[model samples]
Target: MGAGMRAARHYTLALFDALAAAGYDAPERVPRLPIVNPPLWELGHVAWFGEWFVLREASGSHPGEALGNSLLARGDDWFDSNTVPHRARWTLDLPAPGALKTYCREVQDRMLDRLAREQDLDDALYPYRLALAHEDMHGEASLYTLQTLGAAPPAALAPIGQDLLPAAVTPAQSGDGTDAAAGDIAFDGGVFLLGGDQARGFVFDNERRAAPCRVAPFAIAADLVSNADYLEFMRCGGYQNARYWSEAGRAWLMGQERSAPRYWRRDGDGGGWHELRFGRRSALDPAEPVRHVSLHEAEAYCSWAGRRLPLETEWEYAAAAGRPEFRWGRLWEWSASPFLPYEGFGADRYREYSQPWFGTRQVLRGASFATPARLRSPRFRNFFTPGRDDIFSGFRTCAP
Candidate 1:
């Protein structure tokens, strides 16, 4: 848990350092985007979240039992995400960037001081783990925010690679002589446990109510669809064909009026495609997994290829029960399931985290390259609306 917190802190600080390098050292310098929070606000909110759950709330003593004060004046007013409307964030009288960093340091110090005195590791594990996961998520958002602004990649990331850290699936892991996207893997599916329990430490509220789900036999792609695969789709007029798209997809296509994936363009010679990654443009690696594709685009590709997106249940079942040949954990993989609650679902201490977005967003089942290792799990379900293509997302297919 401590190591995870350190990693999150390091990455978050490194991103701020990158911003400082790019003349984005102040709150005013960071653009106000609807998709992301102000950098200063994000830092403060993450710190306040730790303080709220661990320090002020007495390590999640109970759901509605919050009765302590914050170290910072107007911390709740400035940082409570549930209360503070998104647009109002830029208008607030926020502390300077240096002051926000000091607040972050103070919060981390206090949490660590308390952690040092605690003896029962199990009793106090949830709040700390929750804070770590939250920080990791915001850190990932900061990266994409940088991408959106065409800023440099974080100083902590690899200079040449698009990821903070790229984890590749070797031939041994894929059980094939070729790359992960080579072929298909069949699953003779049956009953599968679809969620987490107390046995799995720090299970999210949305992942509770573990129950048996009967899964049908299906064959899923051994790996995610690659850029080369998507290239074929585009080459064959996949974007122009309305029959390949759903009603919502067609609407999105018409709204976007895009002929290629976001951040992609043909070379000047008109010979090949290139993708923009963190302010750098380079030739697309055909073997690399196709990312930044929306769920609508993934569905369109499925139609073009005569396949289908796997259900969230099927995705989870395969990830948990499939052979080593089934590769994942490179990019966020979209599933053909809506984000819905399980039977007997109830909100946890952090009520606003998952309950509000249920049924409105699509389920993304796998972790992306930007995802922290500690937060990566087959049961960890990420969600976003169908129109959001800015995230590090891709898809594989299941035989219909």
Candidate 2:
């Protein structure tokens, strides 16, 4: 428990440093989202979440009158999700940015200081532990915010060599003699357990109730498809082909004239294709997992590859496959299914988590390099509609 808290504290500090280095300390520099928290507002909200759930809840201590009910009362609105209207957060007049920072410091200091004495690691520390994870999610968003504005990603990430990280996927070793051929993870679909079995460990509110369900035997990719993989589809006039895409996906592609990736400039190069990332031009990483593609784009790529997107259940089965710490950090994976409430789903302490996103968005699994491990799990579901590509999301095809 102490170790977890320590990690959380370091992460919290990293978040602040990233923001400051990205120029968000000015508050005015934090971009205002039409329906999302400003980077500064988000920072404070994450801190407030820790206080409300851990520090104050444990000691029965009040965080002063001014900071009184924020963690409890306005917790959801401030830190709840992307669905909320952004213009309204500024209206909340949230503790004048500086006060938010103080609130953050106060909460962190108290939580870390008290973690040593906390005995109810299972119950008492659960909420704050969860809160710590929550903040990590927002930190990733803060990184994306920097990228979208053509500003710069955090300086911590600035030094990463322009050359791609070595490819983690080895298709030649994947029961096939070819690295370019697709791969699969055949799930012996049956009475598969859905959601987190809370008794095992800490899980988010939405993952509380686990249940048994059946799924057909299916095959999923052994690893996420790489940049080289997706480009093959584009090279074959895949985007121009209507049959490979869903109606909505085809329309979206048509609008963008996006036969290629959002950052690519095609083969204008010295013997290889070039792409843009962190606002700089560099050779595309053929071996690295493809990123920044939309669910629609993912779906289209899968179709062109003679495969289908896995159902959410299929994605989860593969993600949870081998129980290998439940992660593939190279890129986010898109599922064939849409986000929805579980069979017996209902609200909990933080009511807005997944209940609100049902019916409107597609499900994404696994985490990208930007995703914090603490905030991810086989049961932690992420959603975005197929049309959006402003964040990190990519996918692999399942066998026919």
Q: What are the Cα lDDT values of the candidates?
A: 0.81, 0.65
lDDT of 1: 0.81
Residue-wise C-alpha lDDT for candidate 1, range 1-400, written one tens digit per residue: 6666767877887887776777676667778777877777887888888899888764332334565777789888898887789989877888887888888888888888877777766556777877888899999888888887778976557663444332332111121122333387776667767788557468888998888888877788988999999999999999999999999999999999988889898899998989998878977999998988999999999999999999998888777753566677878999999999988888877877889999899999878888877777778899999988888889999888
Q: Clashing residue pairs in candidate 1, if any?
A: none
What's the lDDT of the predicted structure labeled candidate 2? 0.65
Q: What are the RMSD figures for all models against the true structure? A: 3.7, 5.6
Candidate 2 per-residue lDDT, tens place, 1-400, comes to 5566666556555656665665665546656654234666677667766766665552322233223455435654564334346565554545555566666767777777877676765776676667767767766776566556554564656653232222232111012111233355555566557787667457765564677666777766677778888878887988888999899997898887887777667665445578666566777778877777888888888777778887877666655544332236556678888887776776654555667778998888767777655555656788887776767777877777
Which residue runs does candidate 2 get wrong by more than 4 Å?
22-24, 27-36, 55-67, 70-84, 90-99, 155-182, 254-257, 267-272, 323-327
- Top of the candidates by lDDT: 1
